[model samples]
Target chain A: MSLSLENVSAGYAGRPVLSGLDLAEVPSGSIVALVGANGAGKSTLLRGIAGLGEAKGRIVLDGQDISELPPEMLVGRIGYLPQALPQGSSLIAYEAVMSAVRAARPDSPRAGGAAAIEQVFDTLGLRDLAMRRLRELSGGQRQMVGLAQVLVRKPRLLLLDEPTSALDLRWQLTVLETVRRMADAEGAICVIAIHDINLALRFCDRLVVLGGGGVLSSGPPATALDADVLRRAYGIEARVEACSRGFAIVLADHALSLDHHSP
Target chain B: MTRHLTALQERSASLADLYGGFIRNRLIAIGLLAVGLACSLVLDVATGPSGLPVADILTGLLDRDALPRGQAVILWNIRLPYAVMAVLVGAALGLAGAEMQTVLNNPLASPFTLGVSAAATLGAALAMALEPDVPGLDETWLIPLSAFACAMAATLLIQTLAGRFGAGTDTVVLFGIAMLFAMNALLWLVQYVASTDALQQMVFWTMGSLARATWEKVAVVALVLAACVPLSMRSVWAMTALRGGDDHARSFGIPVERLRLRVLLRVSLLSAAAVAFVGTIGFIGLVGPHIARLTLGEDHRFYLPGSALAGALLLSLASIASKNLVPGLILPVGIVTSLVGIPLFMALILTQGRRP
Candidate 1:
C-alpha cells in the first residue's frame, strides 16, 4: 500500500535523463504531485517505473523491489499513462477501454464485462461519447478516454504523466477529483506530473519538486513549494499564497535571474 | 423493480448484440466472397484450352468415375489444381498483406513492401541462371526453396533494422522499400548476364504463371497456407490492440516489437510460399487488406480472414480472366491480376471516400 523509490536512474539509449533520483515513502490513500520544468525527467521517471525506460535501481512497492521485475509481472501492479494519446485508432472509446482491460489480464478470461467499460465511461461523464470512434473525438475527450484505460486496470500504483495537459477546465477538475477519490476510497498510491501549481497544491496530499534530474524538495505542498524551490526547479520567481478559503496556490510574477545556455 | 429488471435485460442484450453484430457482418462478407470464389473456380475449370463440359465437371466432382478419361485428365490434372492454387495463394498473400499493414500501421503496406516478392524473384532468377543443385533441395523445388530462403533473408534484414532503430512506424517500411529497389536492381543485373534460355526462364518466372500448377504443388502450398493461417488467428487479438498504435498496445501489456517480429516472420513465410509457387503475382497482397478494412474495419478477427477471402476471390477471378481475356492464348496470371486489380483498387478508393 506504500511506494518508495530509493535511487532510480533511467534514460533513452544509455544517456541518463534521470540520474539517481529518489523519493521517500508515499503512503497509500494519497496523491503526490510531481512538478518540474521541461526536460527535468518527469515523463521518464513515470515511464521508468512502468518498465518502459532503461531504468536501474529498486522501486519498492510495499517493500518489494519491482525494478527488476519483468514487464508482464510489473504491469499488473503499476499503471502509467503517457502525455500523448494514441492516434488514428478507429475503435470506439468503449471498445478501446475494453481492449485495454482485456490486455491487462491476458491470462484471465476476458472478464471485463461491458458494464466495466461502461462504468468508467459513465463515471468520466463520457456516456454520450462512448460509442464515438477515438480518432473522431476531440483532444480533451481522448485524454479522458486514456485515463479510463488506466483506471480500468485498477493498478495499486498509478502514474499520470501530465494527465490534464489537454483537458478543459471542468473535466480537469473532474479528473483530479476522481484521482483523489480513488486514492481515498481504494487506498491506491497515485503520483501525477502536472504543470498547474494551484490545482496540484489544492488536490495533492504531498508534493515532490523535481530539478536537475532529481527531487529538489519533498514535503506537504505548503512546506515544499516555497519561493526557493520554485526558483530552482522552474527557474521562475514565484510566490505561494492561500485563497480566502485557505486553499494553497502559486503565483509567478517574473522570470528568475539565470544564465541561459543555448545548444 | 420489475421495470428496472426489464431495462437491465434489454441493455445487456443490446450489448451482446453489439458484439454479435460485428461477427455476423464479417461472416456475411466472408460468405459472399466465398460464393464469388466458388463461381470463379467453376469458370476457371470450364473455360480452359480443352474446356471440360460443365455438366461433366460437376458430375465428376460428385463422382470421379463419371468423367470420361480425356475430360477427367483436364479437370483433375490441369484446371482443378490451378483453381485451388489460385485461391490458396491469394489467401496467403492477402493474410500476409493484412498483417503487414497492421504491424507497420500503414494502410498501403503489402507483403512485397518488405521486398519479399522481389527477393524471391531475385532468388528464383539466380537459381535459373546458376542452376545450384543444392543437395536435399529437390530439383523441382530448388527455385522455390531458394526463393523462400531469400525472402526470409530479407525479412531478417528488416527485423534487424527494426531492432536497431526503433520498431515504430516507417522504420520497417522505409527499410523494406530500400530493399525492394536494391533487389530490383540486383534482379536486373542477373537478367543482363544470363544466356538466352536461362534469361527466358527467369523472365517468365517473374511474369507469374499458373501454367506450372500441379496437384502435388497445390497440396504443398495448401498445407503451408493451412498451417500459417490458424497460427495467425491466435495473434489476431494482439494485432487488434496494435491498431490503436504501439504505445497504446504496449500500455495494455502487448509486446509490440515481439509481436511485430512474429507477424513479420509469418508474413515472410506466407509471401514466400505464394511467390515461390506462382512467381510474383501482384495486387492481392496490396489491396486485400484495404478491401477487408473497408468491409470489416480494422478488427483483425474478421479483417484477417476477410482479407484472405477477398484475396482468394480476386486472384481466382483473375485466373479466369487470364484464360478468357485472350481467345487464342492464356496470358500470364500476373499480368491479368494487375489488369484486374488496378480497376478494383480504384473502385474501392472512390467508393470508400478516402484518398489512398
Candidate 2:
C-alpha cells in the first residue's frame, strides 16, 4: 500500500500556505517526519491530508483518492492529533478513549470496543491513569491520552500535528517509538509534523522537509538533512554530523541572514 | 517472558474490571438521581397552600375520588400540573444547558446564552405593553404565546446567523451575546413606555412563576422535552468527543461544525419551549449541568440524563420552596431557584477551580 500527493495546495482562508506539493509513492509501514520552521505550513499540510482544513488536489491512499472522501469516511482510517492537547474535560481517560472508539466506529460491538480500549491503554502503558479525569492529568499525561485517543482507532494514515510539543524527552521518545511500532506492525502510514529535527532523524524512516511554501527535500533522514537544507529551510547555519552510533545529529553553528527570506 | 505475559493479562483484566465498575457506578448515580427526582416530584405536589394532607395527595394521585370534591379538584388541576410542569421545564432547560455547554465548550453557556430567554422576555414585555387584541385569544394567554413566538423567532435568527458565519463556538457565542443585549435594550424601551400596571406585570413575568401552568402548558413542555432527550442521547458519543474540543472531535470524524449547529438548534427548541411556557427561570439551565458533571462526570450518556434529572430535582425542590417560602404568599418559583442556585453554583465553581 502507498500514499501519494499530487500538486496539492493547502491553506487557511483561501490563502495558500503550501502550494504545488507532490510526493510519490509514500509506501505504507513507514514513518515520515514533516519538518519545517514555524509558518512553514507543516500543520496546514497535515490538516489538509487529514481533511480537517481546505485543500485542493489529489491525496491518494492505497489506490483511492482520499481527499475527495467525506470527513466521516476518514474515521478509523485517517487519525489526526492536533497541536493542542485535550483539556478541561471532566471525563476519565478511559471514557475519553472509549468514546473516541465508539464515535469513530459506532456500529462495532461493545464487547470488542472494551477490549480494544483496554489494549490501547495497555499499549500506552497508561492503565494506571485510565480512571483519572482528564483535568487531573498533567500536560504530558493528557498528551498521552490524546495520543491514545488517535492510536485506539488504529488508522491506516496517522496525521499528528506536534504531538510531542508539550511532552518531555522520555515521553517524546515513547510517542515516537509507539508511532514507529504502529508503522512496522500495523503497516500504518505515519506523518508527524515535528519541530525536533534530531528526534525526527532518530525515529522516523524519512523526512519530508518543507521550505518556501513547497517541499525542500524528501528522502531518508541521513540523505535529506544537510547543511544546505538546514540553512535554506530554517535560516540557520548548521552541521549534519554522524554520532558515535552512526545516527545523524544536527549541530547548529549560527543563524543565517534572514533579511530577504520570507519564511 | 511467561511471567511478563501473565502480568499483562492480569493488568488488562484489572483495567477491564475497573472500567466495568466505573460504568456501573455512573449508572447507579443516574438511578439515584432518578429516584431523587421522583421524590422531589412527590414532595412538590404534596407541599401546596390549600393545606391538603400528604395522604390525600397520594390517594388523590392514585384514585381521584379518594379526596373530597374541592380537594380533588385542587390536587388534579392545580398541584399536579404545577409539579409536572416544574419537572418537565426543568428537564428541558437542564438538557438544553448541558448540550449548549458541551458544544460551545463553555461551562457558563446555558440555554439562555443563545438569547432565547432574553427574546422571550422581550416578547412578554411587548405583550404586556401593547396588549394585542387578537380575536378569540385569551387575554391572559397572550404573554406566554407571544413569548414562545419571539423565542422561536430568535432561534431561527441565531440558526441563520450560525449557518452564515461558520458555527464555531466563538461566532455563535458572540452573536448570542449580541442578540441578548439587543433584546434587553428593546425590552427596557418597551417597559419604559408601558403603564404602571403593565410595568408591574412585566416585572412579575420576568421573575418567572409556575402559577400559570396548566395541563396544556405541561404537555407542551413535556412533548418538546420528550423529543429532545432522545435526540440528545443519539449524539451522546459525539458530544462526549466534543468535550475534548472541536479539533479532537473532528479528528474522530465527527463533524464538529455541523454537530454544534444541530445541538444549538435542539437546545433552542428545548429552551424556547421551556422559557416560553414558564417565563425566564434562571440558574436551572446553568446549574443543572454543573450538578450533573459533579455527580456523573461528562460522559453525555450519563451527563445528559443526569443534567435533565438534576434540573428536574432542583426545580421540583424549588417549586416546593416557592410555595412554602412565605406563610400564605407563594413567592415566584424563579426567585426561589435563583436564591438557592446561586450559592450552589458558586460553591461548584470554587471547588472546580481547585482541580487541575
Candidate 3:
C-alpha cells in the first residue's frame, strides 16, 4: 500500500492555506513525519486528506482516490486523530474504543468483542485504565485513549495530528513505537504531524518538512534535515549530528534572526 | 504466583460481569418505569370527579353495553382518552427532550422548556383569534391544527437559522430563547386584540389540561410519537458520537450537521404533536431526560426509551395528583407537573452529586 498527495490545495472555509503542494509517494511499512512550524499547514494537510476540510486535489491511498470516494466508503480505510481531545466525556475507555470500531463497521458483529478489546488494551498497555471513564483519566491517559480509538479501527491510512502533545516523555516514545510497529507489521501508511524535529529525525523512516504552503524538503531524515533546512523550516539555528546510536540528532542553538531570514 | 493467577481470573470475571450487569440494570429500570406508568394510568382514570370504580371502568371499556350511558361516556370519552393521552404526550415530550439534548449536546435543550410549547400556544391563540373562515376546517379543530402547524414552523425556522450560522450548542440555545420571547410577544399581541371570551380561553390554554384529549387527538399524537421514536432510533449511534462533541464525532464519519438536522425534524414532530394537543406543558420534557440519565446513564438506545417511559410515568402521576390535590377542583396538569417535577429534579441532582 502507498499514499500520495498531488496538487493538494486546501484551507479552512474559503481561504487556501496550502496551494499546489505535492508530497512524495509514501509506501507501506514506513512511518512519515510531517514536520512544520505552527502555521505551516501540517494539520491542514492531514485534515484535507481525511476529508475533514475543504480540499481540492487528489489523495491517492493504495491506488484509490480518497477525495473522490464518498465518506462512508473512505471510513475504516482511513482514520484521523485530531489534535484536541474532548474533555469531561463520561465514556469508559473500553466503550470509547468500541464505539470507534463500530463506527468503522456499523452493522457487523465483533466475532470476539471482549478478546479483541482486551487485545487492544494490552497492546496499548492500557489494561488497568480500560475501565476508567474518560473524565477520570489524566491528560496523557486521555491522549493514549484517543490514539487507541484510531488504532482500534484498523484503518490502512493513519493520520495523527500531534497525538503526543499532551503525553509525557515515556508515553510519547511508547505511542510512537507502537504506531511504528503497527505500520511495519500491517503494511499501513502512517503520517504523523509532529512539532519536535528531533523526535521526527530519530523515529521517522522518512521526513517531509513544510514551510509557507509547500514542501520545503523531504527524504531520509539524516540528509533531509540539514542545518540550513532546519533554519528554513523553523526559525532556529541548529546542528545535525550523527550520534553513537547510528541515527541523526538535531541540536538547536538559538532562535534565528528573523530580521534577515524568512522561515 | 498462585494467588496472582487467581486475582487475574477474578478481574476477568468482574469485567465480564460489568456488561451483563449494565444491560440487566437498564432493562430492569425500564420495566419498573413501565409498571409504574401503568399503575398511574389506572389510578388516574379511576379517581376522576365522578369517582368511577376501577372495575367498572374496565368493564365499561371491555363492553360498552354492560354499563350505563354516563359511565360509558366518562370511561371512553373523558377519563380513558385523558389518561391515555397523558402517556402518549408524555412519551412524545420525553423522547423529544432526550434526542434534542443529545443532538444539540446540551442538557437543557428541550422544546417544552425552551419556549417551543409557548410558541405553539401562540400559534393556537392566533388560530382562535382569526378563526379562519376556510371551508372544511372545523371550528373545534382549528386551534390545535394551527398550533401544530405553527409549532413546526417555529422549529424549522430555529433549525434553519442554527444550521446556517449559529449552530453551536450555545448559539442554538440563544436562538431558542430569542424565539421564546418573540412568540410570547406575539401571543400578548393576540390577547390585546381579542374579545373577553377569547382572552379567557387563551389563558386556560396556557395553563394546560388533558380535558381536551379526544380519541382523535390522542390517536394523532400517538401516531406521531410512534413514528418519531423509530426514526430517532435509526440514528442512535450517531447521536452517541455527538455527545463527545461535533468535531470528535465527525472524525468517525458522522455527518454532524445532517444528524442534527434530522434529529431536529424528529424533535419538531414529537413536540408539536404534544404541545398542540395539551397547551404548554414544559416540565416533563425537561425532567424526563434528567431522570433517564440518572437511572439509565447516557447511551441513547436505553436513554431514549427510558426517558419516554419516565415521562409517561411522570405525566400520568401528575394527572392523578391534579385530580386528588384539590379534590373537586382539578388544577391544570401543567401546574401539577411543575409542582412535582422541581422537587424531583432537585433530588436527582443531589443523588448525582453523591455519585462522582
| Steric clashes per prediction | 0, 0, 0
Model 3 Cα lDDT, one tens digit per residue, B83-177? 99999988988989988888767776776544678778988999878778879877778899999888888888887898888466677778878
Per-residue lDDT of model 2, residues A54-139, tens digit only: 99899998888985666666675889998865667899998889888887766665723677888888887888798899989888
For all candidates, state DockQ relative to the true structure. 0.43, 0.69, 0.43
Chain B TM-score in each of the candidates: 0.92, 0.95, 0.94
Candidate 1 chain B weakest ten by summed lDDT = B10-19
Candidate 2 chain B lDDT trough over 10 residues, lowest sum: B7-16
Superior by lDDT: candidate 2 or candidate 3 = 2
Error of 3 at B195 (Å): 2.2
- Measured as a fraction from 0 to 1, the native contacts recovered by model 2 come to 0.77
lDDT for each residue of candidate 3 in A74-183, tens digit (9 for 90 to 100) = 88688888886666565667777776666556677672266667777778888778766777788889888888878877778889999889888888899898998998
Whole-model Cα lDDT of every candidate shown, in order: 0.83, 0.88, 0.82
> Where does model 2 exceed 4 Å of error?
A109-112, A257-263, B1-12
The candidate that wins on TM-score is 2
Residue pairs whose backbone atoms clash in candidate 2:
none
> lDDT value for candidate 1?
0.83
- Stretches > 4 Å off in candidate 1: A68-70, A256-263, B1-17, B49-55, B132-139, B160-170, B346-356
Residue-level lDDT of model 2, residues B1-356, one tens digit each, is 99999767756576768777878998999999999998888888878776777788889989999889999999899998999999999999899999999999999999999899999999888998998899999886788889989988998998998899899889999999999999999999998999999999889988889988999888888888878878888889989988888888888878888888899989999988888877889999899999999989998989999999999999999999998889988999999999999999999999988866
Q: Pick the candidate with the highest lDDT.
A: 2
**Docking class of predicted structure 1:** acceptable
